[model samples]
Target: MNTTYYMSYKLSLIASLAGLLYGFDSAVVSGAISHLSNYFSLDAAGTGWAVSSVVLGFMIGAFSGQFIAQSLGRKKALLATGALVFVAGIFTAIPYNFTMFIVFRIIGGIGVGLGSATAPVYIGEISAQKIRGKTLGFYQMMIALGILLVYLVNALVASWIPDSQWGTDYAWRYMLGAMAIPGCLFMGLALFLPESPRWLIDKNRDDEAKSVLTRINGAGYDCQTEITAIKKSFQAPAGAQAQSESLFSRKYRRVSLIVLTMALLANLCGINAVLYYGNVLFENMGIASARTAYYQQVIIGIAFFAAATWAVVNIEKYGRRRLLIIGSFICFVAITLLGALIWVGIASLWMLVLMVVYILFFGGTIGPILWIIIPELSPNRIRGKLMSWATFLIWTGSFIVSQTFPMLTDSVWLNHLFNGSFPFFLYGLFCLLWFLLNLFFVTETSNKSLEQISAEMSQA
Candidate 1:
C-alpha cells in the first residue's frame, strides 16, 4: 500500500519475469518436440538431446551466475541474461540445421540458467522478511504461468495453422520464437530496477544501500535496524580470520550439503523431464493423438498454475520443510500409482488423472519451496555463490533426467524389468527419498529473519 511496499512489489515483479522466460523456453519445446523430430528424422537419442540441451546450458550458466552477479551486480546480470534469451530465441527459431538448433537451444538455456540462479536471489534480497516467501514464490508462480501460457500458445498455433504448415516447420518455429517477446520485456524492465541493497552493502556502497533500503522499508519503518543486521550478517565472528571462503568451507559445509542434496533430489524426482516432454510422455502412454497430448499438457499447465498460486499464498503459513515433505510424499504416491497403472495396462485416462495429481503436489511443494529454502538458508555474504552451486546441481539432476528419460523408457532391458514404466518408478523412488531427506535434514525457517537464519547455520 505504501510507496516502499509498492516499489518492492514492482521491482520483484519485473525481476520475476525472468522466471516466465525460463518457463517459456523450457516448456515451449514440448509442443515442438514431435514436429522437430519428424522434420529432422531424429532418433530417440537426438530427440532427447534437443530437449535436454537447454538444461545443459542451464547447468553452465548457473555455475557461473554467482560470479557474474557478484561482478556486475544483480541488475546487470539479469539484463545480460534477458538479452541472451532474446537472441537465443530468435536464432533457435530460425536455425538451418539440427546442430544449429541444438546450439541455439543451449544458448537460450544459458539464459534460463542465469535467470533461474539470479531472479529468486534478487527477490529474496530485496523483500522484507515478513513477505519474503510470497515474493520469492512469485518467481515460481511466473514459471507456472509461463508454462501454462506456452501450452495455450502451442494449442492455439496448432489450431490456427493448417496441418500442412504445422506439420512442416512453421508451427514449432513460431512456438520457440515467441519467447523473445517476454525476453525483451524482461531486459527492458531490468534497467529500472535497483541493485540488491545487500549487494550494494557488499560493494561498500552504504549510502546507496541505505537509499534503496529506505525505499523498501518505507517511512515510519526503521531502515537502520535492517541495515545494521545486514552489516552484522557479513561480519566475521570473534577470533575468526576473514578470508575468501569456499562454498564448501567448514562453516558452510553442512548447509551447503543440505541445499545441494535438496536441489539434486528436486530435479531427480523427474519434474522437468515430465514437463519438458509431457506431450511425448502422454503419447507414449497411449494418448489418442499429438493434439490430444497437447491439450493434456494444457490441462497439466492449468493444474500447475493453480497449485503454484496456492503455494504462493500459503507458503508463509505452512513453512517450507513441512510443505516439501508433504508434497514429496504425495508425489511419491501419485507417481507410484501412475506407474502401476501403466504397468497393469489400466485406462489411459486414469494415468492422466494421476499425472495431474503428481503435478498438483509438485507445484505446491518442492516446486516453489526449493527456491525459497535455498536462498533462505544461505548466509548473505555467500548466498549468491552457494545458490549458484545449488542451482547448478539442480540443473545437473534435471539434465540427467531429461537426457535419460527417453532412453530409459525406450530401453528393452529396462522395459522387460519394469513393465515399461521404469522412469516413473525411479521418479517415485526419488520422491520418497526427497521426503525422507527433508524430514530428517531440513530445518524450518518460517518467520525467521535472514540474519537469524545465518546465525543458526553458522552455529550448526
Candidate 2:
C-alpha cells in the first residue's frame, strides 16, 4: 500500500469520539463530588461510594464489553455506548434520590466502560500501519478533549451559579448533564463510521472487508493479502509446542498478564484519583476557594489536552516503549515531588506546576500507549475478549483508587506521619513500578501491521 489514508483518518477520528464521551463522564464528577456529598449528607465512605458506584457499572460493562462488540460489530457497539451515555447522563443529573443517583451514574459508567473497551480497537483496526499509532493516539487525544470539555463546562457552570445554590443542589446536576453533549456527538459520529475490516474478515465477510480495507488504504492497497493475513492470524503459530486456542492459552498468556497489569496500573498510578477528586485535592493542597480550584482544574485540563495533542503528533515519532519508559519515570518523579509539596503544605502555584508536569508525561505517553498496547498485544483470534479482560482490570483499579482516595486523605492515622502525602507517595510507588515494568518487558510495535504484531506476541 502506498498510504492513502485520508478516509482512514476521517473514520478513525469519528470512531475516537467514544473516547471523548468516556473522558467527559470520567472527569465531570471532579467538579461536583464535594457539592454532591454535601447535598447528600454523605460520610467519607458514603462519598466514596457515591463516586465509585459508577465504577461498578464500568466493571460490568468491561466484563461484557467484548461480547457486545463481537456480537454487534464495532460500529454498532459504539452506537450502543453512545446511547448508554446519553441516557445515563440525563438520569444521572436529575435523580430523585441518592440511590437513584448511584444507579444512573453506574449506567453512565457502563457507557464509559464500553467506550474504553471498543474505541481504541476500532480505530486501530481501521487505520493503516503507517498511521495506526496516530489513529490510536487520536482516541487518547479525544479523551483529553472530553476532559477539557467537562472542565470548561464545570467552570462555566460554577461561575454562573451562586456558591450557595451550587452547593445546595445545582452544580453536580449541571456538570453531569453536560456530558450528554459528547454522548450525543459520539452517537452521531459512530453512525457514519465503517465497521472494522478485521472484524468483517473474522465474520467471513470477505467482500465487505475488502471494501473497507480499500477505502481505508486506498484503491492500490493489497486488500486480499491483508485479508489473508488477518485470517492467518487466527490460527496457531507454526511450530508451537502446543496449540493455542484462547486468550488464556500459552500463546497469549504472557501478553495477557502484561495487558492486565498495565491496565490496572494505568489508573492505579493515581490519575483517576486526581481527576475524580480535583477540587478536593486542590483544597487539601491549600487552595482556599472552591472557585479558584475549579479554575485550576481548567488549567489542568488544558495541560492534559496539550499533552494528548503531543501524543497524537509524536507517538509515531517516538517508539512506544521509549515513551512509556521515559514517561513513567518522569511521572514517578513528578508524583514524588507532588507528595513532598503536599507534605510540606506548599503553595497552590507550586502544587499546580507539579500536577501539570505529572499530567503532561502521563497524558502524553503512558496514557496513550494503554489505549493501543492492550489491543495491540492481543491476536485477532481473541483480541476483543482479551481487551475486555484488560478493561476489567482498568475499571478495577479505577474503582479501588477513586474509592480509597477520600478515606486515605481524610484518615487521621494514615496522614499523621506524612500529612496528606501518604496516598500520593503510595501512588508514586506504583508509577516507579510502572516505569520498571515497561522498561524491562515492553517491546516497540511501531510501523507494524496488526497481524505482524499479533504474530510477534505469539512467538514471545
Candidate 3:
C-alpha cells in the first residue's frame, strides 16, 4: 500500500523549491548591479535596461508556461525550467560583456517566469484541501527564504573582492551566477517528483493519475472521489472544451480582471523597487556606503523571510482576505512613513526601520497570500493557462516598476521637486488603492478545496 504520511507535504515542498530558484535568480542581481553597471559603463537608463531586460524574458516564459504545463505535464515543465536556470546561471557567471550577460539573465528570468507560474498550480493540485493554504503558502516562504539566502550570499561574495578589485575580478559574475546551485537543486528534486495527478487525469492517464494520488492521499483514500471532482470541474456548456474557457469570456471576466489588477498592483507597491535597487535607493536616501547598504539588505532579507514564514504558519487560521487587509493598512502606514522620512530628510536609521516594517507587513500578508489565492481561484480545466496569464501580468508589473524605478529616482527634475522620495509616495498611494480593491472584490478562500473555490467563483 502506498504511504500517505507526509507525502503531500514532501511533494509540495519540492515544487516550492522552484519559488526559491525564482527568488534567487530575481534578487541576485541586486548584489552585483553596481559593479556590473560600472564594468559595463551603463548609465541609469542603461542600468535599468540591464536590470529589467530579464523581466521581458519572464513575460515570455509566463506567456508560454501554460502550454508547456498542459501539454508536457507539470513535472516535465519544471524539469525544463530547472535546466534553463542552470544553463543561464553558468553562462551569466562566465566572464562576459554586458550583451552576453543580459542574454543569459533573460534566459534565467524565463526559468523564473515558468517556475512562478507552475509551482503554485502544481502544489495546489497535489496538496490536500486540509492543508492547501499552508501548502500554497510554502512556495512564498521558499521565495522569501531564497531571497534571504541570496542576500547573505551576496554579502559574503561582495566581501571577497574589494570595490577596487571588483571590476577586474569575477565577484559580480559570482553573485549573479551563484543562482545555479539552487536551480540545479530544483531540477534534481523535480526529477523525483510525480506529476500533478489532476493534470494527468486531464490528459486521460487516469490509472497513472490514480497511482500518484494514492501515494499522496494514502491507499485507503478514495482517489476516485477526487478524480470525479476534477472531472466535474471541467463540466461546461455543450461542446465547450475546457481550454476555450478564455479569461476574457463572460464567464471569467470578473475573476480575470481581479487576477490582472491584483497582479499589477501587487508589484506596483514598490517591493521589487526596493529589492532590485536597494543599494541605489539607500545611497539616494543618504546611506553611508555600499557596505552599509549590504548590511541593511541582509537585515531586510531576514525580516522578510521571517514574516513570510509567519504568514505560512497562520494563513490557514486567519483567513486570506483578512490578512491582506491588515497587511494593506500596515503596509500603507509603513510605506507612507518611509516616503515621508526620505522626503523630510530623517535619519537613515529611522528610514531603515520603517522600510523593515513595510517589508514585514507586506511579506506576511500580501506576498504569500496571492500565491495561494490565484491558483485556488482558477477553474481546474484552464488552471494552467490562467496561471500563465497571471504570471505574465505579474512579470509585466515587475518589469514596468523595475525598469522605471531607476529612471524615476535618477530624474533630476523629479528628484529636485520631491527630494528623491517621489517613487515611495507613488508606491504608497498604490498600496492604499490595493487595499480598496481587495475590500470590494476579493473573496476569502481559506480552508477550502480547489473545487469549492472554482464553484464559488463561478457562482460569484
Candidate 4:
C-alpha cells in the first residue's frame, strides 16, 4: 500500500474526537462536585461517592468492553459508546434528585471509559507504520483538547454566577451539561468514518479491507500486496491461536507483565492526580480563589495540548521507549522541583509554574505514549480483548488515585509528612522509578511494525 498521510490523518483526526469526550467528562465533574455536595446535603463520604461514582461505572464498562468490542466490531462499539455519551451529557444536567444524578453520571462514565478504551486501538490498527505514532498521539491531543474545552466551560459557567450563587443547585447542572455538545459531535462523526481495516480483515472482509487501504493510500495503492503483508504478519507458527495462548501462558508472561506494568506506571506517574484534582490542589496551596485556581487548571490543559501536539508531530522520530524514558526523567525533575518549592516555601507563582511544567513533560510523553504502546503490545488475535483488559486496569488505577488523593491530602497528613510537599514528592518518586524501569526494559518501538515487534518479543 502507498503509505501516504492524507487518508490516515483524516481517520485519526476523526477518531480522536472520542478523546475530547473522554477528557471533558473526566474533568468536568471536578468543578461541579463541591456545588453538588451542598445541593445534595452530603458529607465527605457522600461527596466522595459522588466524585467516584463515574469511576465505578468506568470499571464496569471496561470489564465488559472486550465482549462489547468483540461482538459489535470496533466501529459499532465506539458508536455505541458515543450514543451513551450523548444521552449521558444531557441527562446528567437535569434538575433531578441525587439518585437520578448519580445514575446519569454513571451512564456518561460508561461512554468515557469505553471510548477511551477503543478509539486509540482503532486508530493504531488502521494507521500506516510511517505515521502511526503521531496519529496515535492524536487521541491524546483530542483528550487534551476536551480537557481544555471543559476547563474553559467550567470556568465560564462558574464565572457568570455571583460567588453566593456559584454553589447554588443550578451551578453544577450547567457544568455537567456542557459536555453534550462534543458527545453528539463524536456520535455523528463516528457514523461517517470507515471501520478499522484490521477489524475488517479479522472478519475475513479482505475486499473491504482492500477498499479501505486503497482509500487510505489513494486509488493507485496496491490492495493485494498490502493485504498479503497484513496476512503474512499473522502467519508465524504461533499464528492467531498462539498469540491468544501466549498471552496467558508462561510463554508470553513477560509481554503480559510489561503491558500491565506500563499501564499502572502510566497512571502512577501522576497525570490524573494533576488533571482530575488539580483545582482542589491549587486551592489547597492557597491559590486565593476559585477563579484563579480554575484558570490555572486551564493552563494545565493548555500545557497538555502543546505537549500532545508535539508528541503527535515527533513520536515516530523519538520512538516510544525513548519518549517515555526522556519524559519520565523530565517529569522527575518537574515534580522534584515542585516538592522542593513547597518544602522551601517558594513563591506561590513559582508553585503554579512547577505544576504547569510537570504537565508539559507528561503530556508530551506519558499521556500519549500509553495509548500508543498498549495496542501495539498485544497480539492480533487477543488485541481487542487484552487491550480491553488493559483499559480496565488503567481506569482501575485512575479510580484508586482519584478516590485517594483527597483523603491522602486531608486525612493521612500528607501535608504534615512533607510539610505540604508530600504529594509532589510521592509523584516524583513514581516518575523517577518509571524512568529507571523504562531504561532497563521498555523496548524501542519507533519504526517497527506490530508484526516485527511480536516477532522480536516472541524470539526473546
Q: What is the lDDT of candidate 1?
A: 0.88
Report backbone clashes per prediction. Answer: 0, 0, 0, 0
Model 2 Cα displacement at 437 (Å)? 0.4
Off by over 4 Å in 2: 1-3, 237-243
| Residue 63 lDDT, candidate 3, scale 0-100 | 86
- lDDT, candidate 4, equals 0.80
**Tens-digit lDDT track for model 2 on 1-460?**
2347788788888988888887898888888888898899999999899888888888888878899999889888888889999998899889999999998899888888887888888987888788888888988899899999999998988888766755658888988988887788888878888888888888889999999888777788898887877888876667752557566687788887788888888888999887888888888777647778898898889998999999888888887999999999999999999899888877668778888999999999988888977788777777898888899898999899989999998899978888889988999999998998898888888988888888888764
Which of the two, 1 or 2, has more lDDT?
Answer: 1
Candidate 2 least-lDDT 10 residues: 236-245
TM-score of each: 0.97, 0.96, 0.97, 0.93
Each prediction's Cα RMSD? 1.5, 2.0, 1.9, 2.4
31-115 per-residue lDDT for model 1 (tens digits): 9888888888888899889999999999988988999998999998899889999999899889999999999899888988998
lDDT of 3 by residue, 165-253 (tens): 65435677888778889988888989999988988888889999999998888879898988898888877867755534877676777
Distance from true position, residue 348, model 2, in Å? 4.7
lDDT of each: 0.88, 0.86, 0.86, 0.80
Give candidate 1 regions above 4 Å deviation.
1-4, 164-166, 238-244
Which 10-residue window in model 3 sums to the lowest lDDT?
162-171
Clashes of 1: 0
- Residue 438 error, candidate 3, Å: 0.9
Clashes of 3: 0
